[model samples]
Target: METQAAETVERVQPHLAESLPVPVRVGKGVRRLALRVALVVEAAGGGVAAHIADLVRELRVRGGVEIHLVIPVGVRFDGVIIGDDVLAQCDTVHRLPMLRAVGRADTIAFARLFRCLHKISPDIVHSHSSKAGALARLCFGPWKQVYTPHAVYTLNPYLSRGQRRFYGLVEGVLGRFRSDRIIAVSVDEAEHLQRVLRIPAARIETIFNGVKKQPLLTAAEARSALGLPHDAVVIGFVGRLDFQKGVDRLVRVAQNILDRGLGNVIFAVMGPGDFTVASGVSADATPNNVRVLGALSQARTYFSAFDIFSLPSRYEGFPYVLLEAMAANVPIVSTRVSGAAELITAEHVGVVVPNEDDVTIFADTIAVLAQEPLTRERMSRNCERAIESFSATTMIERTVNLYNRLLKEHR
Candidate 1:
């Protein structure tokens, strides 16, 4: 069956190749209206970088904006590069020697940022992640600025009550000065901004993250490269190993699966984080059944090897990994936090357990899916259908429209 699946994917690869460079057309007038824009992001990695890179590429190719990217100096990560192909569309790339520091360093960063903003005189300044958003807004003065939190700092369960409240207060205060609009990656996140952070519902907009679906590689080829049997049931997790990712819970879930003696199952984690940082650390860590492939440059290769995908994040603004997994037509299992629940439906997609649920529930859900081949196939098909709503073109068009509207209103 696995061999046949591989053959099917291989046969379809040529059709996928023929569809290269998904066409995007922008009206000449709208292109002409494209304002001078600056995008700010903190240290790059993971989904945030991918999202920004995709938007930049699409904007440069389809829109008329004179785009400038302001990124931290000395930071390198997979998919961080905008590439010459995309860079050709941009007006400039500016590197700031701003360290990802707190206190005095942040003050210095703000100073530098203010100077840069003064020099660039951008029509719009869009910021991503916490540090960049805060600093960008602080330095904006009277300039139009927009922020996307990616997942607000206040959402982390690891923080103390005081810390959460302090962060929330800071965001509320900053909300008054720096933000013209708050872009929430999910509807759930938008609601939180309105209820908890007191951002006006009118000012908040939900824009779902978009992913480009790569041509499917054969499952046999994928498994063989990863050195797994053709018949193995593969469950894959992709994300950073930090506390927010809920990797500790994932381990417990994997252990439960092993304890239940499931046959020929393979578990793989693809991302970076120290195992020691995770709670519930044990001497008997990383059992034989589990493989930790830390931080692959291209997840599509590993994604192809999976029969199912899971993301047990404690909170998220919106996870691009989940979108990528869905695009790959893999069944999903994730916590009902952030946008994960909203993205997956019980009828069409995989299970969404409560955030605090024990690993047993997650493991048992995987067990059921593994045992039922027909159910897995149905879920996979549904994932393919769900992905239609989240193409890169949709994200670019909506974002560009927002940019134009905001620029017009300000003008």
Candidate 2:
């Protein structure tokens, strides 16, 4: 029997690599059995989607791993339907009706998924996010199951204590009885699962999310792209609008930063939210000093224009946005959300605040970073030094190795 050699993968000319799919390697003479991976993800946008996209890219080129994407039927990423361009490289795509967040616990749907996976008989079923994590653990048949929680639902400050306890109970049951293995995106997240869910230390591993590096655009060019005034000091944020991201608090604190009258300091936001005029946090919440991009496919490309990249997330897993900032050598100010502390440990890299909801504190931190040019330059240098630690290539290689290990164990 013969198989394709992924090492001979035809490259997508450097310029077209981002939007277009690179051609997969397959030919008449092409002797390796691809490890079959059935990857399930309910949320098809934001950081987790970026992670999936990167994994898909590397797996297609690296060979020896046949990927089958099991994504939400009606979900979209970058404001477009998950189309054939996304499907262009995958071995298969399963668009099943599944909801993200809320831990979508519908047994009927789970049974249908189980039957589907049973037929495909993937070597391993790797699920992302809390909702998919809950469903994948139950969809177990012959496949080894691997779950990654972008953020643990039980530890989210936005949820009520009672709700947190319920989630904790559910996670405990899943870990004790159903889960095969778990992979946390950060060391903090891995530790939390071990401590809170009592998942054994050996059962979980931390693999940091990573970003692709590119020649950074000049500040002027990046500012032009985002419509920010080049002369102004800008603080940027990129994330989907949701409870976990704490966009509401972001707007308020950004307003406070302006109130302090720090001359020429502006807040630039890339990414959309549900905050319309109908929602209490409407367009008006964006003071004159703030610019909302709604959504931009290449928003992170504008990172160089920012004096500081701020992430006021109440809770998170490993965010691709933070890695993007690191790649751009942008200084950071983030809530000590799950994976943040690990990356923002050094003062030069930026500061991580303990209080998730303390908008004043978050605001104060950003203002200083925005105003201090020498400090920002030093942090930028530090980010350049640390970029290799968050390389997308590294993330993909480790993931492929894990898939192979699971296959060997299964045999």
Candidate 3:
């Protein structure tokens, strides 16, 4: 009966190739079958959404797999919505309501997720981001569970001691009993899981998030399009204008540079949200040298407009923007976040400052980089070479290989 069912699936989905095999226990022998995967994500926007999209696109091309997607209903972040084209790649799409914080509503989210997983009957259930990773793991099931926390909440330095402890406890418990595997997008994240959360080292795998190369504008062309002074040194930022993204820090850095009378330096932020509220400064009070661009589509393509790319993130798990910045041949100025050391191989490539540094430090780093055109040019060339190692193709292939190995062991 199982063999017949597999054959039927192959016949109906000819594009699947149906050649790759996963092992399943049957009587005294093992049987080969197509691996079925269900992906669940609650916070389904930004880099998390991009990661899932890349995985689905590549998995479909590889064939021998059935893919299902589960996301919150009407899930949109800062005007960024998941496209219908990405949803079309999945065999099934399930929607549930989920909140970013722990609350009474999680009961409903968990129940709906449980029902969705039962209907899909996937061989492996993969959950992305913190919210969905926590909820999906709590539901008991025979399917092997894989989790990827884009950035664990406990990693946030601003979290209260009590809040950090509580979240860490939840993650520690889940990591031990619920998860079959936990993928860390950077070595720093994997080490944190082991050292801080006490998650076993053996259960963790580091898989860097990848990005597709895109055509970028020249500095002059991008400046013209953005309505900025062509001769000025533009420092660019691209991320959510929220605490985690350190928009306040970005504002402070910009103010510091301007206060020093760096009249030729300017700042452009490309993402959705209110800078006035985030930076605790009224619209009229904001610095004249800083421009807040709310939600520009394909923000990475405009990277060349800036002499330097600034990432003031409080924390991250291999940011897609950083990779995009490299692909765009833009030198980076980043806080010592998860993936900085791994990607920014040398001082010639970019500068990474300590995360605890004052805004002045960040401002000065950008300031100094701006003056050295030759150094920036060398950094751009190195970025072009470094980015090739983190392509979407390599990331996808490693992920599929992980799945195959896990399924084989499960039998």
Clashing residue pair totals per candidate (backbone < 3 A): 0, 2, 1
Stretches > 4 Å off in candidate 1 = 1-33, 75-89, 99-101, 279-284
* Descending-TM-score candidate ranking: 3, 1, 2
Off by over 4 Å in 3: 1-33, 75-81, 218-221, 346-348
Which residue pairs does candidate 2 place in steric collision? 3-30, 4-30
- Highest TM-score scorer: 3
How does model 1 score by TM-score? 0.87
lDDT tens string, model 3, 123-190?
Answer: 89999988999999997888888999988778888889899989999999999889989999999999
Displacement of the residue 138 alpha carbon in candidate 2, Å: 1.1
- What are the lDDT figures for the candidates, one per model? 0.75, 0.75, 0.82
* Colliding pairs, model 3: 271-295
Candidate 2 lDDT score relative to the true structure: 0.75
TM-scores, one per candidate: 0.87, 0.87, 0.89
- Residue 402 displacement (Å), model 2: 1.8
